[model samples]
Target: VCSPEYWVRHVREAVRFADGVRALEAQGVSRFVEVGPDGVLTAMARECLTAEEPSAPVLVPVLRKDRPETRVLTTALAELHVHGVPVDWERLFAGRDARRVELPTYAFQRERYWLEALTSFASDVTAVGLIPPTHPLLGAAVELPDADGFLFT
Candidate 1:
């Protein structure tokens, strides 16, 4: 496909670039890193993705003409990292005194404790032949031999 005619035809014909992006999206690809001089391709990919989709793909631009090269690349890496992308932190921070810090758990975590309530109230107090006090408005427990159990008044 290196022939002059092939190159000419490739440039002349309308390419299905957006279709290719959508195909990638269909393949469960939710992250795209554009390693170009600018974010033109990233912007185009963003446009190709539909807004109705629940989870949109993350588009990270490696470089920008107006921004510093290192700054742009680092920002892109940070963006990817924040979007659940695995990054080699050690490699990136090589030759530096960077140490990984364990982040503390959230103050008000939303995790479900899912503790099952006690279905049966029969405890050791009841097992020892003594009826346990359960009622909130009950006074001192009084054992009634006729009732065969303690009654609250």
Candidate 2:
């Protein structure tokens, strides 16, 4: 996914949603639980399942954007429990003396998006196309421009 050559293909993910759902079906995955801070993917996942068939499996999200964090988690856990998935509450709460203590409700942080512009010398030069000068042909057929940064082609 880090490769720039395949970057353009990531645009098709939304279009290939049904194919992904079918692949999951082949793997016998009925329940789709997305463990994230929101339900965006869960909604799209449900849409893909419904497109293939009328029936749908248990789709749950661990947290919701609008709702309270604790309430959303509790509801999601309940949904999973009802779907015959065993939840080890004792094991989950083991060892640590974790207790709910009131703290700050939210912390606001802004994201910065910065992009750098690329500079190309050949772009400003008018060439019959590549008469582009090589290193050996620099002084022979290609004449150097008098300007400071003008590209020779």
Candidate 3:
């Protein structure tokens, strides 16, 4: 590949592109990352992989034509991450103020965002068939032993 004759032959002779992909697939390589100005080979790689295999390889393009470079690269990284690729986040965000946030453990489900306001039960707890909590701010009214005496929190 480094020789001048190889380059000349590469241009003059037919290139075994699919054969190279097949060879890599034979070696148990199931991930292909294309580092180029544009994702020209990605589509070709996908076509080559679809014809032969038990599993299709994940094709990732680091840079895409007519797209933001950072967004394309980030999306590629996210795809790789979803495919179980181990990324060194510490090194990736060495100089950036990136922080790890706690994600929801449960699967997020689609829910209605615009809901009608709930009727206020704070005005009267008994209306909801519930007793008020015995907190310092609010508590159930208690009758004192003496007449015309009531305790309130």
lDDT of each: 0.74, 0.63, 0.74
Off by over 4 Å in 1: 1-13, 106-153
On the 0 to 100 scale, the lDDT of residue 12 in model 3 is: 98
Better of 2 and 3 by lDDT: 3
Clashing residue pairs found in predicted model 2 = none
Pull out the clashing pairs in model 3: none
State the lDDT of candidate 3 residue by residue for 1-153, as single tens digits.
Answer: 799999999999999999999888778889899998998998798777744553457888888776678767877887888888988877887888998888667666675445464578656666654456568686556434212245665
lDDT tens digits, residue span 9-37, model 2:
77644457678876896777888788877
| The candidate that achieves the highest TM-score relative to the unseen native structure | 3
Ten-residue region with minimum lDDT total, candidate 3: 141-150
Q: Candidate 1 on 65-98: residue-level lDDT in tens?
A: 7657886787788888888998998999999998
Q: What is the lDDT of residue 137 in candidate 1?
A: 65
Better of 1 and 3 by TM-score: 3
Model 3 error, position 149 (Å) = 74
- Candidate 1, residue 5: the lDDT equals 95
Residue pairs in steric clash, candidate 1?
none
lDDT of 1: 0.74
Candidate 1 lowest-lDDT run of ten: 139-148
Candidate 3 segments whose C-alpha is farther than 4 A from its true place = 1-12, 50-55, 107-153
